[model samples]
Target: MDFARPLPEYLIKRYQGWRATTYSENKGWYRRLADEGQRPRAMVISCCDSRVHVTAIFGADSGEFFIHRNVANLVPPYEPDGDHHGTSAAVEYAVCSLKVSHVIVLGHSGCGGVQGCYDMCEGKAPELEEKTSFVGRWMDILRPGYEALDTGDDSVRVAELEKRAVLVSLENLWTFPFVREAVEGGTLSLHGLWTHIGEGGLEAFDPASKRFMPV
Candidate 1:
């Protein structure tokens, strides 16, 4: 748990060895990306979980995908409170500045933050108010999803809540003017993807089918 300690010597050396190989293998790409700047074809909004890596999951190298990671991959509706809108800023940059053709919201199974939201909705964590933490406020975004669930089985309710939250985020994405305009103009499309971390598989949301299907 000693975070202040430097990386292990063996790991450091291994990374150093890979650096040369990576540079050699991607020399042209690196040179072009650096000179021309990044023009990624897609932008991915995902959860800030160590296990959920956007680049690694999509097999992307530098300048491939613009990424924004936040807790539970939640996208709050546009607000102007002179606050630090990290995720909103990234979305604006991706849609307006980068002009990415597609914006994907990636949700994953076994998400702790999502579970916390579910717990809060069920009144299982009453002491959360004592902490006055930002997570509590952020998790409130899923309140509607939790309230909409009327199931008896706890597991089923949690699963439905998670899926509903993703759908809610998709709706929230349109709250941004840039995202809405691009989608209406056919320049940008929104996609929702659910990843099962244990099995390393993905389910893509199908608007036509009204469900998530294996990808």
Candidate 2:
């Protein structure tokens, strides 16, 4: 298998077939809606890994979810300063502009960025500098999680830390004024989800239960 060439062509053809079927089967509903514009009901913040696809996981078709993907599923505290605010900007658009009812922070198992953080915390990796790289900077957001882990086993600790990171991101969402306002006004809800890729199931963070349960 030549990894690059065939895969791109295969996906393009697959999507073309899907589009044709969608138009014909829906009786031109998609065509009409295309002109009317999109109004997605929910927004998902997820990892940019190819294995974890937001739309596929949620069973969403086109215009169903407003998505933002980064190295790890992270939402940093809002800062009005002139930093490159990609995640913040996405959250602002989803909450303020799109007026999405629900915002989900979707984390997953075996995340490379989370693993990198674990490596750094263990002194297996070097401290990140500003000139280091984009991935290093991104993984820094999960430092609090890494520091909070008390488990003895490295693998267990990393997994727990990743889950903790999701909770952290959920709390960080409140840093944005618009998100806070919407949630307080009962117009918006935030959720944290962890995908167990090995099991092919999702564990949703239940605030009432205060634990993750199968979804």
RMSD of each: 2.6, 3.7
Give the per-residue lDDT digits (tens) of candidate 2, residues 81-165. Answer: 9978999999999999889999999999998888887887677877543446677777778888888789699889988877987
RMSD, model 1, all Cα superposed? 2.6
Worst 10 residues of 1 by lDDT: 125-134
Stretch of 10 with least lDDT, candidate 2? 125-134
Encode model 1's per-residue lDDT on 126-154: one tens digit a residue.
75434586887888887887888886998
**What is the TM-score of each predicted model, taking all chains together?**
0.90, 0.88
Clashes in candidate 2: how many?
0
Clash count for each candidate, listed in order shown: 0, 0
List candidate 1 stretches off by more than 4 Å.
Answer: 1-11
Q: Which residue pairs overlap in candidate 2's backbone?
A: none
**Candidate 2 segments whose C-alpha is farther than 4 A from its true place:** 1-8, 127-130
